[model samples]
Target: MADLVIADVTVNKKASVYFDGKCISHGVTFPDGTKKSVGVILPASLTFNTGAPEIMEIVDGACKVRLKGTEEWVAYAAGSEFKVPGDSSFDIEVSETVHYVCHFG
Candidate 1:
């Protein structure tokens, strides 16, 4: 799949500085008030709780994710995506660098 280009947005460099700074991201906000973060996760295992529904697009590499209420972890590679419901927590295991773009809605 081709790369995504989101036009007319602002970036917040300080966003997504979690997991002892292992996962870093910059927040992107669009003209319509939509928000997302384009970031990369280094090899690590982390869990995140979402305030809103998140659609995580795997832009490069891959990661194994166990969504809220799921017992199995699923692998998502580049050009693939997954969703996590609002107010839910999910676990992600990255064996390699994984590039992702997370859309919050």
Candidate 2:
């Protein structure tokens, strides 16, 4: 069996939550450590607080990505992979929705 496991998502009052799966929280094992992630997006308008270094690929439709201190963000259509760092906050003006990945240590 794989020694490393993906822990079940938990709900705690002190932590900020985005929808459900996507969030910037602590590592399950390393409680004091920060673990940020972006699970799945919905058709609804979405705003993001930049969490960590991420690698995202467009699964369907389209999305607009931007960071706070950046000049501009790149847009992408389906089957596109975009990398977002876990530094500043950003917004996603999505057409249908965008599913991305994020990580921090």
Candidate 3:
């Protein structure tokens, strides 16, 4: 079994954290004191925490990012930077390996 841990993204540093079945790209703090990061979904992964959203830059393959209230999900290519708000909920569908730099604050 994996241990449970908590983190504060308000400081400054890169943290590659490993959870139960997923690896998360954590450590982000905004000017308004908000924290966020990207959770790397392992094969056969599903999450219930529709985590606080922010902005994501696709650093790799195809990524399907859907907004909380939008009818259509957007496809982001490499180097694509977009905002989806922290309070807004969403999901991800990755056909291939997708990498994102999660910025929250």
Candidate 4:
């Protein structure tokens, strides 16, 4: 797990809401130019497309994710993480309200 406290980052006040408000996130930028999004996904099934590779760190709650071109749905809970390739997509079913940090690269 990464640090719980993220310091020296600029957080965008405006949120990026998706899936008709089922998912909401705020972009954050580090001092070194790294970018991430801190967000919450309400209980729902959603598909997300990635323009960049992403490592999604689960902060709280649980979800099952199936990556693009895959059939198996992997379960992830608090303290767990999953990676999605760039230019691909993933289907996520959130059983609980999921709090996560999406690291982009």
Best by TM-score: 4
1-105 per-residue lDDT for model 4 (tens digits): 557867899999999999899999999999989999999999999999999999999999999999999999999999999999999999999999999999998
Which regions of candidate 3 deviate over 4 angstroms? 1-23, 26-53
User: What order do you get sorting by TM-score, best first?
Assistant: 4, 1, 3, 2
lDDT of 3 by residue, 1-105 (tens): 211223544645666755464545756576667665554544322222334555766666676666667778777766786676655566666666666666654
Which stretches of candidate 4 lie above 4 Å from their native place? none
Clashing pairs in 4: none
Clashes of each: 0, 2, 1, 0
Over the stretch 1-105, how does candidate 1's per-residue lDDT look in tens digits?
657776789988577688888788999998878888999899999998999999999989878999989899999999999999999999999987898999888
Q: After superposition, how far is residue 37 of candidate 2 from its true place, in Å?
A: 6.4
Model 3 TM-score (2 dp)? 0.58
* Candidate 1 local distance difference test against the native: 0.89
Residue 70 local lDDT, model 4: 99
Residue pairs with clashing backbones, model 3: 30-105
TM-score of each: 0.92, 0.51, 0.58, 0.96
| CA lDDT scores, all candidates in order | 0.89, 0.55, 0.58, 0.95
TM-score of 2: 0.51
Q: Which stretches of candidate 1 lie over 4 Å from their true place?
A: none
Query: Candidate order by lDDT, highest to lowest?
Result: 4, 1, 3, 2
